[model samples]
Target: MGVNTLYFGVDFGTTNSSVAVYDGHRAWALPLDPENDLPTSLPSLLYISRENEKIVGRAAADAFIARNVDREVKTKQVDLGVSVEAYVGAEPEKSEVFNPALVDPEVRHAVRARATIEVNAPGRLFQSLKSLLRQPAFKSTEVFGTPYQLEELVSYILSPIKKAVDGCAGHAVETVVFGRPVRFSDCDDENRIAEDRLRTAAKLAGFKNVAFFLEPVGACVEYAVSVEEKQCLMVVDIGGGTCDVCIMEFQGGSGPEQRLAESRILSVAGTPVAGDALDREIIRNRIFPLLGSKARYGPSNLPMPQYIYNQILDWQNIYKFNNEEMINWLLAAEAFSNCPEGLRALRCLIQKNYGYLVAREVEAAKKRLSEVESTHITVQRDDIQIDDILVREEFSHIIEYTLGEMRECILEAEQNAGIRPSDINLVLTTGGTCLVPAIRAMLEERYGAGKLRSRDSFTSVATGLAVVARYV
Candidate 1:
């Protein structure tokens, strides 16, 4: 079959990405990370080596683990330059007459401070680039002394998926439909900017015909295929970075295009709090205390600064603490603290870039909690050893506020659809977060356990997008 005969859908999500193909009748998700032993979806990750070599997906994680973990960082100090300041002559005194003509001025100059950086570090690993799309201030970031635009970084993730899709199709496929959230940001303009950025990245990745579809709507479309009769359906897609809710009407007869044209879509709403936020809660509530969050230093025995521990709450932001200033502060704190073991471990974590390891453990614990009543989160490497038992009840309590927000999001979608909770005939939940027991319980409490239906948690959106691509 030629490329023109097929339709493609790319779910470029904040946490994981997947590509699906449809040839008018059949739709399936292509394996991007076959060796993962999990879902076919690819983890959204990028690694840039010291030599500027870029790697993506599973290989990226493997490369980071092989290079950064359990390695002692080597640092160096190098002079950057000197800064010179010019001012009026001291003789002018308080009178300080304005310069009607040229006058002698005093000049002060000092050597710029030297910066400490890891000279033998392997590379930098990045995740959650999709979350930065809506921020106007974040245009580019430096990687190995080279500046890379946001679109360029995004393209790094998309290009490989494009190549994989082409290999599967036996020819290059440039046309694609990508799934997007209902809102990348609270502001409409910012959301548009995020879409534009994503479009630009798709083009950079060699997509010739690109289209966008709401993620929740895509999930709804996938669920609609099995509907035997007309019914009110609500789709709740809670992914890594955002929670998207859609209320719609589903009937058996209509095709994807007709569904879009008709009043099938009643309402769509989304919030930025989702899986990652819950993971952060685990790190903050369960792991942070063991990592020196409660340590005290100085003669007065004051508690450690909250900001130091805050940096590690979000694994993606933990790299910011690797700078010279933060390192110096950590060293000072470690020397004076009543308990130096945790602070020392914290320093080791930053110096060796072990944040990814901690994130992986937390995510694994979260997954286990969904299936079991209790699990243990263990983060161990060199001097760092944190083992904590996390129970389902405690996990729910840790994420109580986040769960409340998600419930509100569902209510928002229902209210916008002009219907009460009872009006919904069926509930379709997708994405990794929906597998959480607390989240499932909340949905069951609202709509009854019998009404909740779950398709493929990871690939439904991509499949739905493929269906949309075929018809629309």
Candidate 2:
């Protein structure tokens, strides 16, 4: 028999990236390692630093000598070689402060040379690079001395994931499929820019031939293979950064013709509000109060700078708070603010770069709410921590607007596809956000619970794309 070589599918998700390949007879998802500790999907995150250290998530941190557990407790804050309390067993000893000022060669050199172990390690971490692509004004972001284009930053996220996939494939693979949403998150409503950035990133990340699949359509392929009857199905994909819907004409299970299922895609729609938006709802409404959003300053009792609270709400802009201008501004306000402790807390979050860390916990809590009536999450590092309970009713109220947008997207797609909610033969919901009780209730209420089906939240798109890769 000729050596079997199979095509690959890559889902470059906003919250996590996943890779899968068709190995002739079946599609297989590529995993990271011997231990399943790390999700087979890599976190869609990148951490840059002046100090040389291997950066991995909490799962892989233990295997390395100079490792920093993202959520590990720090007994004391580590700074540039002075007046710091002891951190009994904190790994990495310290975290290097990465700032935009590093763009100055002299300052960059000085920090690299003189900063302590902690001050010289993991400089700054960036998240949500995928969602920012649609912003026409967001041409580039400065990371140290270089101004990295959106595509370049995307490559930073894609590069390592490719390395893991390539290792599993055991060869230098070039051709691949990429999945994207029906609409990108942009006020300008420009999806072309978002796509071009993705293409450029894939090229930079080591792919020569590329194919694109609408995420929801790709998700439908997974359900298409499970039944022996042809069906008109709607795929509901609510991921970290976007919610996408697709009406697809699916082939019956068990035939070569099913590989050509892409031809049956009817209509697609999407909105850029899902898990990340939901997380922000919690962070802004629940967490910001603890940070100073409610605090006033000066004789006029003016509201504390709204901008400071806004920056840390999204991990993508969290680094913006670490600059001298913001820090100095906070310091000046602390002298006048009625709630200086709140301002101090804000400063601590920025200085330690805990935005992404806290977000991880918030996401966990959101997932917990879907399974139960209420749940609690804890965000902590050293002496600082925010422990709170999240009631589903409150969370649903906070995300009312997001749910509204998602409902409109589904209705629009159904209308465009010339189908009624009753017309869908099957309704397959996938993606992490799909698990939320509110999201579940919305869909079940529309189409009735009888027709609803579920797929793996993290891997469904990749699995579906792998099926699509079999033929085209």
Candidate 3:
């Protein structure tokens, strides 16, 4: 590599993103968003304004909350187009209907239908676009009447990171190595499609040369820097959108690039279950009842619709209730519900668009529970008020399904590697979700507690990717 040539590593994770650079001797994460509490990482979120201006990271989240949360929802009529329709009276002859020239000009007047659209939102907020890369059907979406392809949405997130990188390098660097999940989707074809989409996104972000690196393997590279002798290692990366496990044998002597090139990758596996799923489960199991998920409504006293509350699981889905049909349904349900207070709170949540706020509170509570035995969630917004205590045991139970999937993925990786848990010399855990007590206990039980090691949970992949970027 020429002294003038610079390579940067970008870990564009599902929940957060970071950029790093490696000098010949060392790799370190750059301060992408120093104002942020987590200076090295930025939340992977984007907001597109009505004027088509884009904002990302913490600012994007703050813009969404300040502009949307607790704001009154209003509707407007938008003219799609004009249609010409010919009408014939019930007593009109068939010739009049069949022959347009014979029809009266009065009957041929233009008919226009105006579509009712929800308005008043300052902008549209997009999150977790990385998770949708593997989905073939999620091609594009319109924001404020302008259509944006999936890659374009991702590019917005990358653009800011690249700008920061260029600022640090004192030049516009076009070459980068990005970390990707071992498998974006269950199918190999879908994984390839996801990578291609990511590559396109990087190109749109102004990169000329983009390379992909496995997320788990990147974590492994960081861990390998400390190892001097040969060791069989299993690296588990549980981030916001996916969990990836890689089993490899590493002998560290040379630099990160040479060490990785000489290492043996035994097997790898991944599943789309991680911190985000755990957050949703907390919303579903702990917070739903408070929002009247089980309340009864109508003359027959039927139970409230589970589908309505399920929308709270995803912040984007909460906006669906901004329309007339859903608003009417919520109003009618609140009027007739046995738990009127809960339904009213639910109305406030949807009408005021507080789903993101609620999600953030729940996610914070989840993180707190990881460190403490119990945590309290207090969200007081207009008619909506919630005070709940989440115990660690209950939190563990809430995420059992997700944890079980992770366990299954690990077992699959071990089987593919033709090795048992005991055969592994060390279990390296990285990513945010690895901090959960249950996850740590699970690893300790499967592989001896003494054999488990952890690198920096959040920035290891970015640092390792920087190391790889040096060679790529």
Candidate 4:
């Protein structure tokens, strides 16, 4: 069995990425992480942690060791599940516990693969490789003394997924169709730059021939599968980093030519305000105050610099809080605030690189709130303890601005599509945010309850891209 298909469709997203393949008879998603038995869609997350003895992707291990590894090593257990566990003994040991020098090359590469992504927990964790593609200020970042360009970093993230694709297809896949948002971030130039970067990454990831498709349009293909009649539809994709809306016309059927010839791409619009923004909002509103972000400074008794609190909102930038200048600034603010307890809270949170941990808690809470009226935001670190209550109403209010912006984006897509809401036959919504009750209600309110529909929120794009891969 050689490469079974001509092309694969890859939806390389901000929070999670996914890949789908098309055979002559059908289209289906391929699981990118066989090691963890992840679903068809892969978390668009890449983490690098050298200090941690365990190396697993997404939910495996933290994929990193906090800088306290030297100290924590005495407590952190080697993953007994792996053969390497015997190398470190049955119990937790000292700092040099599972040195890579003594391990097999496969284990060493697994531990050291993609260290240049984002989060660095006390210096062990990193993630969110897709977001950096749009940052003009980010040219290169170094990891463990190795300098990496954004493409190389993203490519590294894609490497494993490519391997999975090859193994599943029985032959190496060289041509691919990549699903991308119509807009990346907020600007046209940035979107173009990001697409270019994605192209490079796809190439670097092992696809020799690559193509691009708008994310929602790809989802349109997914939705059209069930319908037999031609229809006009709107697709709203709420992803980790951006919200993209598209209006398209589809001729629903399995014939590749009929599928390709009839689909018309109409309005495409997007905004940077999406799930990550909501995650940040949760961090700011519910988690910050508990971390002494709102406390007054000492002598002057003035409010601490707001950036000190705001900077840690994104786990992407959490490591920035540990720089020397930021430390000095915090120290001065601590002295001026005169509140030793509050200042200490801030210092301890920053010193331990608690942002990622807190953000993770906030995220888990946010998801819980979506399903229930309220949830708990637990922050338990060395000395910083916070078990705060967060209600869905409060979360709704916190993310009101984001909701409003998403509303505006939807309307913009409608306006640009040159059709009234009534003219649209169906409103297809997907992505993690699509599950949000408030978001669902908002769509239902505007599109009429009967006109709105839902696809597999997380895997729709990849599935559709798989179908379109054959044609595009």
lDDT digits (tens) for residues 418-465 of candidate 3: 998889999999999999999999999999899988878889998888
Candidate 2, poorest ten consecutive residues by summed lDDT: 82-91
lDDT of 1 at 23: 78
lDDT of each: 0.81, 0.71, 0.81, 0.70
Off by more than 4 A, model 4? 1-6, 35-38, 50-56, 59-61, 65-124, 252-256, 323-339
Q: Write the per-residue lDDT of candidate 4 for residues 1-472, one digit (tens) a residue.
A: 2355445778887877788777755777777765454567666555554442323256432443334321332222222222322322322222133343555555423322111112233334446667778887787876555566888778866787788788886788787788888778787788788889989988998988888888888888877755678889899999888888989888766665676677888889988768888888887877677666777742224455576566566655655565443444445444445454566666666656566667677778888877899888887666577888988888888899889999999999999888998999989999888888889889999889898888888778987887887665
Candidate 4 achieves a global lDDT of 0.70
Residues 113-141 of candidate 1: C-alpha lDDT, one tens digit per residue = 44456657688888888988998898999
- TM per prediction: 0.88, 0.82, 0.88, 0.83
Range of the 10 consecutive residues with the lowest summed lDDT in candidate 3: 83-92
**lDDT tens per residue, model 2, 1-472:** 2457776788888877788877766776787433344466766766555452223333322222133334333333323321111110111212132123324344223322111112332354656778888888988876556677888778877776678668867887888888988888644456888888899899998987778988887788766765667778899999889999999886665664553543477898888888889999999998888777898743334576566567667765765556543454454445457877776677667655566667778888988898899988787664346888999999999999989999999998998999888889889899888989899889999999998888888888987787777765
Q: Which residue pairs collide in model 3, if any? A: none
Q: Which parts of model 1 are misplaced by more than 4 Å?
A: 1-4, 72-117, 254-263
lDDT of 4 at 328: 43
Model 2 reaches what TM-score against the true structure? 0.82
The reply for model 2, stretches above 4 Å from the true place, is: 1-3, 33-38, 52-121, 186-189, 251-254, 258-263, 323-325, 380-385
lDDT score, residue 439, model 4?
95
